[model samples]
Target: MKIAVVAANGKVARKVITEAIKRGHDVTAFGRHKENNTDASKYVIKDILDLKKEDLEGFDVVVDAFGTWASEAMHLHTVTSQHLADLLEHTNTRLLIVGGAGSLYTNKEHTETVASGPDFPHDWLPVANAMADSLNALRKRNDVHWTYLSPAANFVADGEATGKYAFAGEELTLNKNNESTISYADYASAMLDVIENGQHDKERISVYAD
Candidate 1:
């Protein structure tokens, strides 16, 4: 499949692009910076916000892996989501967005993980809240096939791609030790699984270690 990965410079995006290439998929990597590597030449240096509808004309699947760093403001996520939605409106392709954990819930009416957690950083709240709003807006659109993949509350950089994880909708999943966590590699794997398998369209699903 031909895949277009936005924010190809990101850690998760880089891993996903590498895996996609290793799996023999033709990937169009879009990002702001061009790295120094063989795959770096394959990247198209462009800002997502500046992308026109024609810019995304020929991709099979579009992955919104572009993310704002912890130090950056949340407006970036909101703008990216809006731009992605606009781009999707012009294509027949499927969109797989990488969303934050703030939208996931441990209960029906509460969002304890990131929205109201004591450990949740106060500075990152605006961005998290913006992403949550973006997800909500995307859910209302029926013209495009979009899926939101929210990682666990504690998605650390450690661990390998075990390829063994649990999925949940709206509600958060807990591991044996009663914790929520996942590795970036496994998260990328799961995203690709959904892309290849064509599952969970027009839905938001959360993944975590089990």
Candidate 2:
């Protein structure tokens, strides 16, 4: 499959690009700052917001890996997402967002989210809200085919890829150790697997290590 990853310079996005290339997929990196994945089929240095419809043509999937750690710019998540969705609306191409765990439901009833739960960290609320808002915006639109993959509560960066993972719908998941966590590599693998499986459509799924 042909894949394009926005904000491909991010730690998580870099892993996604590398894993996609390693899995024999044609991968392209689009971002403004850096080109860390030399293995990509092409690297385009452009702000995701500035990406026109022509820039997104001919890709089976566009992965929204855009992220911001600063509190002030968190709204960029929604802005960039809307931009991509607007461009790809009613097209055959799928837009898969690199989502956040905060929006994942904490209960089977789907009333609560991770960020709303008591144990969630206080400092992570800003970005979590941003992520949730982005997903919410996508939900209100039916024009584009999109999937949101939320990593487990503990999104490990330097952890190993066990080549094993499990999936769930909306609800947060915890592994055998009773921990909600997954390494960046395994999360990337799970996402690519979702892309290859062609199962999810306009849905949000959570991934955790096995």
- List the candidates' TM-scores in order: 0.89, 0.96
Error of 1 at 143 (Å): 2.1
Best by TM-score: 2
TM-score of 1: 0.89
Residue-level lDDT tens digits of model 1 in 1-210: 999888887888877787788778898888876662325346777889888788888888999986775545666776787788878884678989988898787576764646767777887677678788788888888878889999998787767989888887787778898998999888888788888988898999998987
Which pairs in model 1 have colliding backbones?
74-127
lDDT for position 23 in model 2: 85
Full-model lDDT, candidate 1: 0.81
Model 1 residue 205 distance off true place after TM-score fit, in angstroms? 0.3
For candidate 2, what's the RMSD?
1.2
Best by lDDT: 2
lDDT of 2 by residue, 1-210 (tens): 989999888888888888888889998899887655545768998999899999989999999998887988999999999999999998999999999999888888999989999988999999999999999999998999999999998999999989889998889888889989899999999989999998789999899988
Q: How many residue pairs clash in each candidate?
A: 1, 0
